[model samples]
Target: MSTGVWIDQIGIDLDAGTQQVDEAIVVMHSAFVEYGHQGQASGAMVETADSLRAELSTGTRLGLARIGGQAVAMVKYRTADGGTLYFGRLAVSPEARGRGLASALVRALRGAARDMGLGGLSCSVRAAETRNIMIYEHLGMAIIGREDRRSLTGAVIPVVLMRDV
Candidate 1:
């Protein structure tokens, strides 16, 4: 019943706990600081250990990537309608970029989704974040649609919805 993956020496724990969640939060905030600087609101910017713990209690799963025992990336995911695994808040520390951890985590989750009889993986990426869109596209996911969502700060965030082929 263990959910984990090792790729290129990075360890991904799918059933991470509070301590790991705390570490992941640090990584997330650090990674998403750009949004704050851009005067945009990101849910990842507001996540706390308690809030994420609440999410876990409600069946959302967290995946953390660690290198040398330090958290460097994380993602939150859950089963969604249409038999797809919906993942979001995928963040990698600035220092951890170019290591393929993001793609590795998605690959691992794709396996988990398949094990659960899910059809595919899906996620919403900010339309402005072309790098993330390209990364997902490289993983075989295609843009299905786009939508504008209101952030907590009332900013209209345009996001591209993607699904794996």
Candidate 2:
């Protein structure tokens, strides 16, 4: 029951060459920066366009959300081994939080993964981001493990790995 946005018009599995590529990147950068400023993201951050393009070249899919032609949220998904869809860079605009948009995007990613015969959808959340963890947990995702991500600046990010089971 999300409002102020339309889901039917989103572009799935988009390429870097798409016209909205810049928009998608903006959504990611803004949302990630919001989380970072709130002390939720200590060291982990999305890389530059060159790395993103390389990831897209490896079959990563971007899930974009737009309302009235404005990009609001996005996530990157890639099919991992043994049919698991790994997702990252999930972000929702500051104005769009608490409206079920994140959950909707998760549902959309789950559906897309299932459509591809993927066993499940998986993602990593910074361990200190309890708000994020609870949101995903409420959506039926369980923490499966932990991972340590070393940022380019050499900061260690403790992350919780979760998967829909």
Candidate 3:
């Protein structure tokens, strides 16, 4: 199926509680397992699930991209630096890979941030994750700082980027 068709098969909804977030967490864990071991670095931490659940339960905004009545992707953010939005834990399902879902989700997030009158959005990405770094750069994010020795989940990660809305 085409990208539009695949996207159309799903509904993007603002999840109201932790249940939906938990489901998305399951998918994300599995996806990481499938894609993580082969990468240059370890993937996300399973401990992140609890924090994600908490974020969903209490956050001002929580979104899920549901495909065929199932949560296939999730994106969430928080206000940082007073008005700067920090986005993290954006994940898409393995079954839904290469369908432009991540880009679509990020676009939606930028729109939401704009409507909220936020000055900009920021995220930290691993320097080794070239594909994701490329996507963020392509979306107009610019690197602002680099951390040399910090490890996100035991793997060296680098570079914080911010983009004005």
- Top candidate (lDDT): 1
**Lowest-sum lDDT 10-residue window in model 3:** 1-10
lDDT of 1 by residue, 1-165 (tens): 358778889998987866577787899899988898887868777778889889888988889988998899999999998789999999999999999989989998898888888998999999999999999999999999999987755678999999999
Which pairs clash inside model 1?
A: none
Off by over 4 Å in 3: 1-10, 39-43, 57-61, 148-155
lDDT of each: 0.88, 0.72, 0.65
What is the Å distance of residue 8 in model 1 from its true position? Answer: 1.2
lDDT of 1 at 41: 64
lDDT value, candidate 2, whole model: 0.72
Best by TM-score: 1
lDDT tens per residue, model 3, 95-141: 88887777776766666667678876777765666788778878878
Q: Which digits, one per residue and each the tens of the lDDT, describe model 2 over residues 65-109?
A: 766567787777788875788888888887877767687788777
Q: Where does candidate 2 stray beyond 4 Å?
A: 1-17, 35-46
Worst 10 residues of 2 by lDDT: 10-19
Question: Candidate 1: lDDT over CA atoms?
Answer: 0.88
